[model samples]
Target: MSQNYPQLDQATRDELVRAYIAIQQIYEEKGSIPKDSETILKRYQGLLETLGAIHLGLLVASFSIVLNFFIVNYILHLLP
Candidate 1:
């Protein structure tokens, strides 16, 4: 990815490389979120937020379907 940032100064590129190493170390050791991951995630918050909204919608739809099934089977005695 640094190849894509040819215009970046050496110091800036070094910082980014260090950040990637830190991030990789955290992920490898914990198998979960790393400390200060919010800094990275914030960079792509718009895309992440959109994905979160879609996930929430799917969860709610699934719950609604389950609730409807219960209503039909128990409340309305429509299923055996």
Candidate 2:
């Protein structure tokens, strides 16, 4: 089966690329992942999750607005 992937914006994609480079550099220099790098990655993950939530919220709000417009128009038409 084909899998669908979420499309990431350029800035987020660039951030991930930078993170990958940092991890690779740390591994090359120290032969293991450091605590600081792990923490930074975690923070990035949290930021991405928060952004996803905001997008979802905006989508829901826009849909509600469109629905409300139709509902109000229907009610108004029924009055006269």
List lDDT for all candidates, in order.
Answer: 0.85, 0.81
In candidate 1 the C-alpha lDDT for residue 56 amounts to 100
lDDT of 1 by residue, 1-80 (tens): 55887889999888989999998888868967655656767888999999999999999999999999988778667545
Candidate 1: the clashing residue pairs are none
Candidate 1 residues lying further than 4 Å off, grouped into runs, are 1-38, 76-80
Per-model TM-score, in order, reads 0.46, 0.49
How many backbone clashes does every candidate have? 0, 0
Top candidate on TM-score is 2
**Model 2, which residues run further than 4 Å from truth?**
1-27, 30-43
Per lDDT, the best of the predicted structures is 1
- For residues 1-80, write the lDDT of model 2, one tens digit per residue: 01233577667777888999988888867867664546765769978899999999999999999999999999999996
